[model samples]
Target chain A: MIRMSNISWRFLSVWRRNLIVYRKIWKVNFLVPLLEPAFYILAFGLGFQGLVQGLSYGGKALAYTQFMAPALIAISIMYNSFFETTYASFVRMYYQKTFDGMMTTPLSLEEIILAEIVWGATKATAAAAVMTLVLGLFGFVNFPQGLLIVPLAFLGGLAFGAVGMFFTGITPSIDMFNLPIFLFITPMFLFSGTFFPVSGLPEWAQTAALIFPLYHLVELSRACCLGLVETNPLLSLGYLIVFTLCFLVLGLTTMRRRLIK
Target chain B: MDQQPTAAGEIILQVDNLGKHYNGVSAVAGISFAVRAGECFGLLGPNGAGKTSAIRMIYGFAPPSSGSLRVFSLDVADDWRRIRSRVGVCQQDNTLDPDLSVLQNLLIFAGYFQIPADQARERAEELLHFFALEKKREAKVGELSGGLARRLTLARALINDPELIILDEPTTGLDPQSRHLLWEKLHALRARGKTFILTTHYMEEAAQLCDRLVIMDHGRILIEGAPTGLIEAHVGSSIIEVSGADQELVDFLAERKVEFDRMADRLVIYNKGNAEIEQAVRAGFHSRQCTFRSATLEDVFLRLTGRELRE
Candidate 1:
């Protein structure tokens, strides 16, 4: 087995390098995601509340803004993870050939993949945290949960980041990236209970939505932020954990083959 | 029964009958060579000659279909990571991160080798200075000229002080002055006892930089020796070029029982010296220009690999 400390150090170094590249355009980094969650809160949470009526869970009516706040946070994490891993990672892989540069060292393919996932997760979690504060400022999110959202956001990020990387491994060009974002990610964001509950959908649609890990992420984030931890939180957590492991393995293996072969 | 000396130096790398096939066509046929410590070995080949494939095998980037390869006493199959840590590679295409400044690129690569941040910064600065790129340290790699980018690539390869440096056509697209600068830098590094394995198509580059080299063609070794030795063995001492001359010299040389090859507009008289051939040309044919010079590695390459342009 390789040394753990070496792997961790390499991962942190790669993470720092990625941050340096991102810091070059910090305005775009902060402003883009900031506008996203705010737009979602104003347009969907406030505008659609009058049309869709209240959401009743356990015979109690939850405010539309509060019910959707955690889901919006989950969506932001997923979007950030997907954006960071897909476009940014693809640029590094194909255009920059940065992985080729790194592989010349002692760093293994596993270390590179893990480092990428960690960076994506960090970016996603930071965006989620900032959006969470924005929600609090607008009096939309009222969770007293002490930083649980951070780890959940991280998990959400890991799931999407791994999945995004999996797509990137198979994508031959930057234009092909649209297939995953439009066909899979956009549908998940719209129908995976991000802005509304999935219960009202058709049985087949609900079943298909259940297949997406984002549905579980939305459910888990909502449960944590609303102080309503269910007895079966493990189910959603288990789904995300399995999704993360599978995509991480697939992404890492495919990328290794693509690079080393 | 035969025996060869096995104690010249430790065989740091060995490839026995290595081959790589793409789509059932061999890019690199069964070939074998070994590199010893402190030797600047070269693979001299034209484009599409499979030098890249061979280097890829040595670095464990691609597994050879049929070979027993070893690096630093470790099997390539089992110890690639260990081997990679001790080796550095500069590919034909520049691999610097374009968005990062020159210094940032070096620091990031040093980080990949798990160097401490402080040491990485210091080494990056030193490498910048070594390449005469200290002034451009803060410039983004995208802004550097081709020569400067290549220098940065070389400097980055030396970040970890690798024991084995592999360069694939490292000076292919540089200006003459840039090429000379790179050669000087490489020579200085070689003086410090760093073993380098480079592949280049330029005959002068091979002659100037390589201590020993293998001429490769169609994925196979055509000849291997020191540059001057190869020229001496294949091309003889001197070649006389007579341009603007016709078949009269050829006929005269034939009458004198002289050996030569006739081209469309010139006759290449291969011999020990220009005395006999110049006499023949002066006595038989009225030529516009006649020049005699010592044979070069280019002639040796042409003789071994033929004059056909390799696509």
Candidate 2:
């Protein structure tokens, strides 16, 4: 039932609408993703650097700023994609009636869903670009190897965005959103190896982190940032790809039922 | 001029026994009507009736559950995408983008149809002028009064010079002045040969605007005709209402074998072109309050469906 051609250029029209509105409210912390990561780096980098000369994660000697910067990069993508697709899309779908308004036109539900995913991914990528520049200025980046993280972060965003949209479609009310955020997203943020090494966690906790999408994103993105190849890099990428496709299909299928009728 | 439509004209939309059901509950059941070119057609029904459902099918908001619906002589099931491009819909709620300014909303909507930039601007400007909204062009959508916001919504609907416009309760909550202003705008559009299919429960709205309309109730068309024709057919030229002292009046009419509907306090006698009903009411209920007036769609709905249309 889903066809990419159904989306086509019409997806851009919805994306353009979002950009136009975003441009108006850019002053209200539009740079939150960029600034948050730098602040985290400054705090963690300075705080940990003073206490200890260095850090070692997964048995690799590295500067404290070096290890944390990559994790923070993945964190930026996670926060941006989750917030944009969940809270922002919820307001647009239910509160603002933007989705209902679009359905009156020739725009199909598929195009609208695709556009929303693209918009979330684009915002996350924009944040990644800013973080990449900061990392380069501070000489924390592995140069061109860090470039690979850009596309990976965007794909990571596609998965997170799709997951957010599925909840947005089925939530009975605005308050019901808190269940997923508190139970699901908060756990992912705390345990996805974004702050510390997931390997350091207890056996049960580490196995649970592996099931979270952000954990795969953090592992893939940090490896890309440091130019270290995991034992089987394809496993990580393949995990993210499978999750992305599964959530994409499920989220869009549910949202189409919610929107079209 | 004849108040009734002289000719049905070229049918632009046709429905045959169209039905819609949601979760095993019927919203529209076995209803059919045709909208012709250059006519303001209306579906008149109460809140829980099938007015919105019927129009929803016409504009591709909901697919019909049974039977066939065609617009511009194209089947809705196969050609809704094409049907949507040519059909303009002004929804019941204000669906205007509050983030954008008045002119920007119209121009952005024009982009959906891939209307060329220059042409989109021209059409938007012309619509602004037509709606008398040029002065508010720079203001955000939320800044406008409700009337102006509704007018902007209608103006946005016209951005593509749509062949058929479908409006769902366009004036449901506006003030009298605003309603009159909107009615005037629709009237002006009608003068330009644009076809319209609207839904409203306001009897006066149907009588004033619709060239042909159906009085729908409980998911079915109870009666449909030109407003005056339905009024004349189901009711008559006039009806007499006697309120208070209603028991004697009711018994007198009943004993005389005159048909009338009785409420708690009033007895309404329908005329059948004989002075008997009228003269009897005048002779028997002279001491009570009696009033006479021409018939309206309200009378037709009550007569045919046995319930007030507004309820």
Candidate 3:
């Protein structure tokens, strides 16, 4: 078993360094993700609210803007996690060869993987936090459980970040990343009950949606924001925790094989 | 003076018949060598000669397809972490973060080794001063010149005061002055009893900096010795260069008793000094320039590996 405290300390160091590196390129890096979510919030949430009728989720009448706001925040977290972990990890692994430099030191492959996941999660959290504040300012979301949103957004980030690293381990070139993002991630973002509920879908599609960890994350976020806590919040949390552990293990193992051989 | 107890002439690293294959072809095949404590051993090979592949195995970047590697008497398969902590490597490429400043790059690498932040900063400062990069401490790595970037990489490798430092083509793209500066720094470090394993295609660099080296080609060691010893063993005592020779001079020398090869327009006489060749050239031929010099590592390389260009 790996020591959590030792790994946490190492993760924090790598996370802080990644943040500093991003801050230097913040003019380009921050603007892209920040503007993307804001555009989605404005165009899809606020712009389409009047056109679409109200929907009933868990016996509560909610407008499209209010219904989509929480999921949008969750989506932001996923995008941030995925983007940060995959592209940045690729650059560090191949182009910059920064991981090669680190592996030459006392840092183990486990520590490096943990550090990358933590950094991705942190970026996801920061993006989600900013989007949450922006949504609050626009009065699009009235989240009663504001405190829960932050940690849940972070968990959502962790889930996607771990999966991103798993892909990073297998990516042979930068171009291969496009397939996973377009084929897998786009479908997950669209069909995971984000824009619409999965209640009326076919049984196979619904079952497949359930296989996506993001769907549960979106559900958990929506429940917390709408203050509709259920008896089985633990189930969704357990699902997310399990997903995180599986992806983390897979990413660490693959990275070990790629790096340490 | 905190004088530490040092190992007395102990072999710290060993590789036995190491081999690595990519796809169906072998990149490094059945090559073997050992590095003693505090010795600067060089792997002298041209491009595609598998120098990087061998170094990668030594640093645990990749497992050898066959053979064994031991560091500090510990097998690499079992003690990779311990071995990594004790070794520092500077790869052929510039691996520093382009967005990070020079000092920040070193500090981040230090953190990888789990050095505390304050101590990391202290070490970065000392390294910057030592490398003459203190003035550019806050400059982003992308803005630094190639020489400064290379120096910073060297500094980053020294952050942990590693026992064994591996430099793969450390001076590849630098100017002559920068190359000399880096060589001087490496020599100084060696004087302080740090072991270094370097690989380079530059024969002059191998001769100047490496205490002993092995000549490698086609993924195998062709010969191994001190630079002077290899030259003596391969190319004999001296070289004579005779220029401005006409076809008549070439024909006469070819028919007469002389061992030489035509390098461009100049006839280079092997295994003999200028005085003997000068007498021969004056007696039977004419030349505008005739000079003699002792054999160099370059001559040894050309003699053993032919003058044909390797793709």
Per-candidate interface DockQ score: 0.69, 0.67, 0.64
Tens digits of lDDT, candidate 1, B86-160: 888998777799879999899888887777889889898889889999999899899999899999999999998
RMSD to the hidden true structure, all candidates = 4.1, 3.7, 3.5
lDDT of 2 at B248: 70
lDDT (0-100) at residue B288 of candidate 2?
Answer: 86
Best by DockQ: 1
Please give, for residues A144-227, the per-residue lDDT of candidate 2 as tens digits. Answer: 888887898789888888888888778887788899999998888888877767766898997888788888887877778887
Model 1 global lDDT (CA atoms, 0 to 1): 0.81
Flag regions of model 1 displaced more than 4 Å: A1-9, A57-59, A228-231, B1-9, B248-264, B272-274
Q: Which of the two candidates, 1 or 3, achieves a greater TM-score against the reference?
A: 1
Q: lDDT score, residue A66, model 1? A: 70
| lDDT digits (tens) for residues B142-204 of candidate 3 | 898889999999999998778889999999989999999999999999998988899987889
TM-score of 3: 0.89
- Judged by DockQ cut-offs, is candidate 3 incorrect, acceptable, medium or high? medium
Q: Which of candidates 1 and 3 is the stronger one according to DockQ?
A: 1
Give stretches of model 3 more than 4 Å off. A1-11, A23-46, A133-144, A202-204, A229-234, A253-261, B1-5, B243-259, B262-266, B272-278
lDDT of 1 by residue, A1-261 (tens): 222433445577778888888899988888866787788778876688788676854245777777777788888899889888899998988889887777677777668777888899999988888887787777766567726788998988999999988888788889999999889998988998776677767989878888888888888877766765322578889999999989988877777666766
Going through the candidates in order, the fraction of native interface contacts each one reproduces equals 0.83, 0.57, 0.77
TM-score of candidate 1 relative to the true fold? 0.92
lDDT of 3 at B15: 87
Give every prediction's interface RMSD.
1.5, 1.2, 1.9
